[model samples]
Target: AKQIDDLTLAIIICLSRLFLHISADSKYYQSFFWIAMSLLQIHDTKLFASCVHFLDQIVHSMSDNGCFRGQGLATFCASARKGPSERMLAKLDQLSGLSFKYDFSFAVAGHLLKGLKNVGTKAAVTRLLNTFVEYSQENNPANVTGYFAAILPHCGDNLSESCRQRLLSCSETGSSVFNAGMVPDKIRASLLFTYLVTILKSSESEHEQLYIYKALEEGAHFMPDCLPVTFDVLMKKMEQILVASQNDQMLTAVLAIMNCVYTYGLESSSPVATLNKQYMESIGFASLGSADQFNQNQKGALIQAVCRVLDGFLQL
Candidate 1:
């Protein structure tokens, strides 16, 4: 009976989170969100984990049942890499090692990816990446790239180089020769790209920023070949930011990234040049007449940064 109450309360919190954050049609979700939180303030790790798992299932059900089909999500399945087995659950029943099994679904993976650097023990990170790599080999490779995007920032730095290499090799082949699945999965890849760059914008660590920049710089080289739609989405992100961004620091960091990639293309002639030019032309940076709103100083700073990278990124 006590366990039943916890599950009942958790389901309510789950609904509150999904609807409240996904859309803002009413204030009830907001009120319920806090109310659920206050109710959840307890020391029971096991109960918390169970509630989270149940919450994941609800979101997954919504996705799988065509609730968010208009939003372009094919399914809301948790992108969990490895789910706990009966044995594992039984162990949890016996002793309190971890409060609950962590969800590895793609949505959860994005959050986990950001926190991997802080996760204890190198072996743990290695095991997760290895599991992801193994899953990629068996399933659609592009799906795994979502997980890859999360991990790439910390890859290639002697931290997870072996697993990183495994990921690159697997992506080279993908799940098919024609990549029929990739075509429909573009939205997922695009959202993953957005998650990555947006996180970079909010991050305060210079070291992490460099890793993200370098990872994106390299991804610019390969996206066109493996995931063309995702490449377009990333370019759109840049163009959108360029035209609308008022934050000088953000604009500055964005330009540095552009500079790194544009510089990369100058020497290597990577396809980033072609895709970037198309995306820039689409934005019509040369005729952004909306700059009248920003003061002269902000406009000047933005224009200089845009022009510096545009000289090479744009077509003459």
Candidate 2:
């Protein structure tokens, strides 16, 4: 009997998550949803956590509040899509700071993406993502990660693509949408590049790293068009990495990112090529042999390899 109950709970959880994507109006969906919720109260297994997760999703999407929110948004956008609503925008306004507090930033991003076709949806997502960019410029470098996840996935003429276009246009103007409390535009740009290359450096394999960097550069092509960043913005970031290159892991990623920028960063010419000389001269990559053991030998071979980028070449 106990085995049967556990099996019942497992099946209910699976159905809830999978069928949650189905039309909410369907009779089977309504019936299954209640069954899942009821089972959630009875289940005491460790998997109850996952069951609660699905239940939270169900509540967010199917509750009367979501419907009310969706309806208000629909009415606001009804006059041929001018923009998002004051209330919906207010909800979005709370997203960046709140999601960080709850570690639900990505979950919120995913939910918005899922609802891109629903009422007030695009404006909600695009607005929130834009705020994240603004946030990254000032305090949360991780905001860049959220920003990328919002756009890098599959979707049609959706909010993600729309946000991408808006950002691209905004980047061209070298203007900021964020207010006074945010970080300087240059610092935001630097943090963005650091986050990008750091992820590439953390990849599990050489082949994976290559694939990741390619994908990263493709995302980066959108960078100059999305934010107030420029080649000079990226160059400033590269300089930061160079001065700190005694961390061998960072140096490898830095070298690869420089090549990506040089090869795929910009259309005409990237100023990143200039960072090579700056890095070669930094003590982080060099030695006063008599000065200190750690300083002289730390990442020594890597220093030789990376500094060669200043010579205008990619080496093995």
Candidate 3:
């Protein structure tokens, strides 16, 4: 029975990857996201090793533009229940070098974020993020925004103070070119949102919180739904943003309120619950079929907003 279960799991991962490979549309790619999610659940080291080997094979065959897909695969691997072996880490290192040739830095950033639980691997990931941040700033490249955006989620006490200082500095000057005609609105929005989200999620120093509150107020003028769902802890944060005396800060506070309502104000369900269901199904989990409970229009609108933001980042 155990052998049979293992076989079934292997088959599912392979089939889901194949489906993902064939699907060009985001929706279809999302449909097979479950394969990666399922891979994350496996505990058997040997079986996990085999899965990473197969994904590495896929990475080798990718075109230069297609390399980002491999980075995405690496992110999935990092999200697995266990850490990688020395051999796998070496492979990740090799892939990281190749990832710079394409716009795969965001995918690499995702993997780095997931791998941060380990002291050694986390150091490697931090170095990689630092390199990307520096490269982006020095070269003033376009798509590096996506890569920097990915790193934002993992920024906190775990990151060095130097790294945090660099990120904060980027938030100020990074958007300058974006505000100029050089960058598109979508890319600008994505970069701004990424910086905002990172600031919000990071350590709650009063100075840092004040900076984020000011930035969010400025950002709310453009993308209104940028705030994450506000529960108890987040509600207090929102309140602090609201209490600021500046009119721009108040505008951001209002936007945060609106986002909380739109995100968590479901009559019978929560947005987080709905998003989780959608995410699980995309990764190929057995369907609970409860996602249909939300108004289709509402779900579509929320998804559209997110996609628009992502697309904007990609444009950068």
The clash count for each model shown is 6, 3, 8
Per-residue lDDT over 1-316 for candidate 1, one digit per residue giving the tens place of the 0 to 100 score: 1222556556655664565355423423222222222222222333333333333443344444444443322122211112322232223212211111221224334323323433332244335544444332334444555455545554435535555555545544422112234323434433344445544544555555555544454444434332232343345555665798675654665576567555545324333535643432332221111111112333333333323322322221
- Angstrom error of the Cα, residue 109, model 2: value is 6.6
List the candidates' TM-scores in order.
Answer: 0.36, 0.26, 0.35
Off by over 4 Å in 2: 1-52, 59-201, 205-208, 224-256, 260-316
* Model 3: per-residue Cα lDDT over 1-316, one tens digit each: 1222567557746764675356333432322322332232233333334434443333333322243343443333333312222233223223222121222343334333333433434444455555545433333334455444434434534545655655445455533223323223543453344434434544344544545555544454444443332222344556655676355745555566546456554323343635643433332221212111112333333333323333332332
In terms of lDDT, the poorest run of 10 residues in model 1 is 285-294
lDDT by residue for model 2 over 1-316, one digit each (tens)?
Answer: 2222556547656766676577855534433323332333222333333444554555445543243242321121122112222223223223211121222233234333323322334344455445444322312323334354443332212434445554444443222222122222433333333333333332333443343344344445434432222344345544665785465654565465566555553445534534522331231211111111112232333233223321221110
Candidate 2 achieves a global lDDT of 0.36
Better of 1 and 2 by lDDT: 1
Lowest lDDT 10-residue stretch of candidate 2: 285-294
**Local distance difference test, per candidate?**
0.38, 0.36, 0.39
Prediction RMSDs, each to the true structure: 18.9, 19.8, 14.7
Best model per lDDT: 3
